[model samples]
Target: MNERLLPVLDLVSSRTADSAWLTFTARLDTAHRADLRTARRLLAEFGAPTTNPHEGHDMPGMVTDEELAALRSASGAAFQRRASQHVRAHLEQAIRIGSAEQRAGVHPATTALATKVVRTGSAELTRLDRLDRTTAVNRDW
Candidate 1:
C-alpha cells in the first residue's frame, strides 16, 4: 500500500459504521450479477481473514482489484474512466441510481457517506498532492 493511502485507511477505519456498510451494500445491490456474487464472497473472506488475529486491522480501507472490477461492472466502462474525475461525483452517480431503485431512505446521510467512499477511492492517494495544499495551508494542528 502507498504511504499516502495511510491517512485514508485511518480515516475510514475510524469512521466506519452503518453508513459505510450501507455504501458497501449499495455497491453490491447495484453491481453486475456476475461481479456482485464474487465480490461479496471476496469481501467476506477479506473482512474475516482467518489468518489475522486482529479483527479491526485485518481488513483495511484499501480497495482490491476485485472490488474495482466490481465497481466498474456496476458503474459501466464509461463511468470507470469518468469516476477518476471525482470520487464524490462517481459515488453520487451510484447512489442516484441505486438508492432510487432500492428505495433507501435518509438521502442526506447516504449522500454524505457516498462522498466519503468516493474520496477514499484508489487514486485518492495521488489526489492528495494537489488537493491537500489548500487545507494544509489554512489549517493549524
Candidate 2:
C-alpha cells in the first residue's frame, strides 16, 4: 500500500496548487515512506522478501495501471480530483488492513508496525476528510 501510495502522493503534490492539500500530501508521503522502509527492513530481518505480492491484484484501493496513466495524463484540477480519490481510497484500505494485522499478526515487530500504521493512517484519513470537505465547499477543483 505504501509503495503504491507514495508515487500517487508525489504526483498529487506536484500537481496540486492548494497549499492545504500540498501540506497534507507532503506529510502523508513522509510518514508512509517511513512505514514502507520499516516494513521492508522487518521482512528482511526474517529472511523474507520485501517484494509486493499484491502486484496486479484487484485488491481494495489498489491503483490500476490505467488509472495511473490517467493521472499522469491529467493536469491541474483533473489531476487533483483523480489523485484525491485514489489517495483517500488507499488510506481507507490501508487502515483496515493495518487493523487486521494488529489483531492477527504474531510477530512482535510486525504487529507493532501494524499498530503504528493504523494509528497514523487513521489520523491522516481524518485530515484527508477535512481537506475533502473544505475542497467541496470551495469547489475550486
Candidate 3:
C-alpha cells in the first residue's frame, strides 16, 4: 500500500454513503451538484480495494461517528461551515499526500490519480471558500 495514499482512501471509505456526506450533498446548491458527484465518484474509486489492487489496509483521519453526529445536527449556515471545514481539511491533506507521492516517485498511475485528486480537490475547496465568504458578507448586511 502506498503510505501517501492511505489517508485519502480511508477518508473516502469512511465517508461514502455516510449520513454526514449525504446531508452535505443534499444541502449543496445546484451549482455544486457536479462537483459533489465527481467527489463522490472519486471517493468510491479510492474506497474500492478490488478496483485498485495496490491499495489495502486502513489509514488515519477517517471521519468519526461524533463528527457525523455533529454534521447531522447542524442546520443552514452552521451545516455549511462544518461541511466546508471538513472538506477543506480533507483537500489539504490530499494535496500534501499527493505532493509527497509525486516527490517520492510512486507508480505513474498512482501519481496521476494523486495529481488529479489534488487539482480537483483544490478547485472544490476554492469554490466552497468563495461561497462561504459570499454568505458571510450577505449575513453582515
Candidate 4:
C-alpha cells in the first residue's frame, strides 16, 4: 500500500479487529450512553418506589436510597438531569486524553507525513509485540 493507504488501513483495521475482539464493546458503549438517558426518564417516574422498581437490563446498577433522595432533591421539571451532568463529565475526560495523545507524536499529524523510516526484513520485527507474529509474513512481504 502507498503512504496514504497505510495509516488509513492501520486505523480501520485496528478498529475492526478491536470491534471483533470485544464483541459487546460497541454495543455496551451505546447502551452505557443509553443508561444516562434512562436515568433522566426514571427521575420523572419517581414515586414512593412501591409502584415501579425501575430496574432494567442496562441500568447503572442499583440506585441507593441516598441517591434516590439526591435526585429527588432537585425540584422543577428536572428529568434525568444527573445523568446528563455525569455523561458530560465522563466524555470531557475522554476528549482531554485524546487531545493530549494527538499533541504527542502518536499520530501522523497533518498528513504532511514525514517518512518514519521503518526498516523491513528484520528478524527483530518478526519477534515484536504481536503474539500473532504477522511480522514474520511482514518481513516476507
* Index of the highest-lDDT prediction: 2
TM-score preference between candidates 1 and 4, better one: 4
**Stretches of model 1 off by over 4 angstroms after superposition:** 1-38, 41-122
Question: Candidates ranked by TM-score, best first?
Answer: 2, 3, 4, 1
Off by over 4 Å in 2: none
Which of the numbered candidates is closest to the native, going by highest TM-score?
Answer: 2
For candidate 4, write residues 1-141 as lDDT tens digits.
121112222222233343331332233244334443443444455432332344332233233345445544543213123322333333343334334544563434311121111211122123222312342243332
- The C-alpha TM-scores of every prediction are 0.21, 0.91, 0.57, 0.25
lDDT, residue 26, candidate 2: 88
Tens digit of per-residue lDDT, candidate 1, span 7-110? 22223322333243334424423332333344345547556453434323413433344544444443322332222233333334443444453355354544
Misplaced by over 4 Å in model 4 are 1-28, 31-79, 105-141
Error of 4 at 132 (Å): 46
- Rank ordering of all candidates by lDDT, starting from the highest: 2, 3, 1, 4
Against the reference, the lDDT scores of all candidates come to 0.36, 0.83, 0.53, 0.31
Residue-pair clashes per candidate: 0, 0, 0, 1
Candidate 2, 11-113: lDDT as tens digits: 8756778888889888988898899889889889999866688886877777887888889888676777788899888988988998999889999999999
Model 1: per-residue Cα lDDT at residue 26: 40
